[model samples]
Target chain A: MILGVDPGLTRCGVGVIEAGANRRLSFIHVDVVRSDPHMSQDLRLLAIYNGLAAKIEEFAPDTVSIERVFAQENRNTVLGTAQAAGMAMLAAAQRNIPVALHTPTESKMAITGNGKAGKIQMERMVARLLNLNTLPTPADAADALAIAICHALRPAGALEGGEREQHLTPAQRQWAQAAQRANHGRGVKRGM
Target chain B: MILGVDPGLTRCGVGVIEAGANRRLSFIHVDVVRSDPHMSQDLRLLAIYNGLAAKIEEFAPDTVSIERVFAQENRNTVLGTAQAAGMAMLAAAQRNIPVALHTPTESKMAITGNGKAGKIQMERMVARLLNLNTLPTPADAADALAIAICHALRPAGALEGGEREQHLTPAQRQWAQAAQRANHGRGVKRGM
Candidate 1:
């Protein structure tokens, strides 16, 4: 499954697309998960983290594709968006899932055939690609769908790297070592 | 040593404050780590994470206090900020050390006796609190100092409550336990 995530502070548009046998997309689903504004920023981020984790569990997508943040004028605004995007990445990472980050230009080009395509053009392209009558609602959902289609077009050669380095940190790797040191050393607490 | 992080997109400002006995604070280090603008958002966030961890190891902070994000515009911007925040949080959490999250209002109230305070007001208060002749360079560095001050103001009662809630996920307790299980399983597979 190649899942697309359009992450934002207010609402994260998620699209799941399963690239199946015979080169056919066997499944697709789209929805917008809204992040709470009334809560404190930390709580809102916690909501995003848990909400996305629950959604990921429900969808069980083996891979996730998230749009990359491009540019921002306000420093504060950029910080909040970065936090939300990080939470999405962490959610996928915690589940040991593969993630491919797509820049806005790349995602735009994948769906609209032009990097500078307008929002409506990308929406129409996504609708056409998914064989839907009407475009996905509220532009963000359509953009998420387009992002999904972008992942679907990933060349097999690119995927040859095949799901390593997505593991935990070097410290985590150390803890995975044999018990030789555990028993060899005097009883002592090891820092993570 | 207490490490305080004021996460931002272009510049992630950090301050290391040594809170010695008698409630005295000495500036250990102050720095702003910059991320490449052209790199993907994930890479920038990863840079922040790696840089923060290296800083912690270098400074050997006994405590960490990070300011909570409160910006409320541009959903994409918020997501990015949240990503940086999450990365910082994850780094601390992995260390099994308790981390304190302080909001802007609380930090302001602690330092300046006003919950609603501007950046200049904060910089001035920080200068007065630490009795510094000159203001901390760039508002971000001073904000980081304020976060450390916020942690220094932790009452005995506050410490108990805060210590108890280390990574406490009310509803997601089950999920974290499952994750621990998977981690242990991986450890076993790797012959730990």
Candidate 2:
């Protein structure tokens, strides 16, 4: 299963599917896990983590794909959103699941065949790809599903299944984390 | 050496501090990375990544700490920022160095004792910490340095140490991605 995560503080949209030949996908699920912004940052992070964890528990997916934390203008706001992103990452990491990081373009291109596709185009394509007549409600969730589908379609070995799990030796887990962290995003050069 | 990253699209702020025991960080280096917002998103991301890489190579810090990414009320603004943060993380991860992510509260607390510290309080505390005559210029740089110090003091395990490189295997690198796609975020968690 490919899990797509559209990360945000005010509203994170998530979608999951397995894109196959002819743009076919196995519809596992798509949903949004929201937090109340008025609450403390910690609470907001916790809400996203717990809510998503419940969804994950139900789906039992083998991997999680998320957009890396993005910077923004309102410095303070970016700070909060990054914290929220970290919390979401930690939730998956804590569960010992492999997480892939993709950018908006990669996802957009994967879904719409055009990296610069508009929001409406993406929504339309997502619905079409998923074989749904009505477009998915809450565009964020639909976008997330597109991202997940993109990851599923990633080249082989990207989501080698069933390795990540709790209760591994400390040394073993640390090595796994290092490898996962380094490989979270693709297409970058070997080193900065 | 601790590298501080204050990420932005128009002007990304970077500060380097070699904080030794009993000595204030006397601003080892300060630089700003500017990008044209008019460019395409891919180019903008490349600019931020290359800019950070160039800065890190020049300073050669052992640790990297960056302010967390946040979002604003505007959707387009948030989208841009998420990309920048992703690039920053990609740059930092390339070196096998952990990127310390600090929230605004923690940053303010680090610069000042109060969790709800104001900018002026932060300026004063930074002056005291670095024993400077006045608040640092380009408030963003000072903020980055302060966040670097905050990571040094707050959590140590965020970034993986270099010692574990030998334990990792080539096959285990792709673990830790969630295969389930879900849109999860603070204030935006519900209604998939």
Candidate 3:
């Protein structure tokens, strides 16, 4: 089982999935933990942290996947996102669960075969992939599901192994090259 | 007693102090909690969270003061700083300790009477204020002390009071006005 976290101050999206052989996947859970903006900052963070920690304890995911966030124009949103992301990472660390970070583009490419896929398209793809009758409410939850699928289907050694290259399908190789080109000279951070 | 933390990825500065009447203060401890950059991102965050939690338990500070950070040019640095700051706030929240945030300018102004004071000048002032025989090694430590003192000396109502306009010294009122002007139409987030 893998847990994917979409960290945010107002509503943090969380998704859990179980991956079987031959790329089979099943949904374990999907939900969002929200906090009121009027609450104190520390209290808000505490709520998110506690929510994630409790989920970790209840689900017992073998790995935690987080979506990487870039610095947006709005500093407030960035701060809250970073804080929520920190809590997700810390909760996994406290429980000794391995973590993997996937960029939004990577997750999009993995799900829809295009890095620049639109939000609605990605949501449809996620629902189709999971065989869900309805789309996940609140795009944040669907995004978390995409992140989990991205990590689950990553190249064998892309995460833990140190190597120049690894085996990849034709589509996967194309996306990898495209992502590299997109990131070239941009100085965009890959992950934490 | 209050604990101030200058949150960072590589070296997080921590300072403890006791505030007394008439603006008098005494230092209890000052140090840095460092994490190796080579470690995994989650592990590094874990190290910081554990260190601050241990300090809170050992020192029993009434409040935790953190230096507020703004988004900077380097997204990686900003993310790390925000993550560290998040951990500091979370540790305080777990213990039910009140958390305070002071901007760098506020700390510099409180310590040296100049918001734009140089690093060396601020260090000198911190040493003088603490009556230390030697400067705090690694300027981050001194920066933490400055943050603690800034919060300690702030008007009682500035942090917790509902009506901030009612209680303000001339200098403070000027600073507040200047800060508002600086942040006009920028949507810059003040610390929570």
Find the candidate with the highest TM-score and give its number. Answer: 3
> What would the per-residue lDDT of candidate 1 be over residues B32-149, giving only the tens digit for each residue?
8777877655566667777877887787677678877655645555555556666766666556445677777667765665667788888876776677889998777888888887
What lDDT is reached at residue A175 by model 1? 26
Candidate 3 clashes: the total is: 0
Computed on C-alphas against the true complex, the DockQ of each candidate is 0.12, 0.05, 0.51
Top candidate, metric lDDT: 3
Off by over 4 Å in 1: A21-23, A73-76, A155-192, B1-64, B67-82, B88-146, B150-192
- How would you encode candidate 2's per-residue C-alpha lDDT over A15-47 as one tens digit per residue? 777655433577767788898978544345556
lDDT of each: 0.65, 0.61, 0.82
Q: Model 3 chain A: which ten-residue window has the lowest total lDDT?
A: A156-165
lDDT of 3 by residue, B76-177 (tens): 688889889999999999999999998888877666667898999988877877788898778889988888877776644344454764545455455555
Question: Which candidate model has the greater lDDT, 1 or 2?
Answer: 1
> Which candidate ranks first by DockQ, i.e. highest?
3
Q: Order of all candidates by lDDT, from best down to worst? A: 3, 1, 2
Interface RMSD, prediction 3: 2.0
DockQ of 2: 0.05
Ranking by DockQ: 3, 1, 2
Q: What C-alpha lDDT, on a 0 to 100 scale, does residue B153 get in candidate 1?
A: 52
Give the distance in Å from residue A127's predicted Cα in candidate 2 to where it truly belongs.
Answer: 1.1
Expressed as tens digits, the lDDT of each residue in B1-192 for candidate 2 is: 888887676777788877664333565776777778775333455577678888877877877777765454356455445445545555655565566667666666545545677888887776766677877768777777777766544412211443433332221111100101121223322111
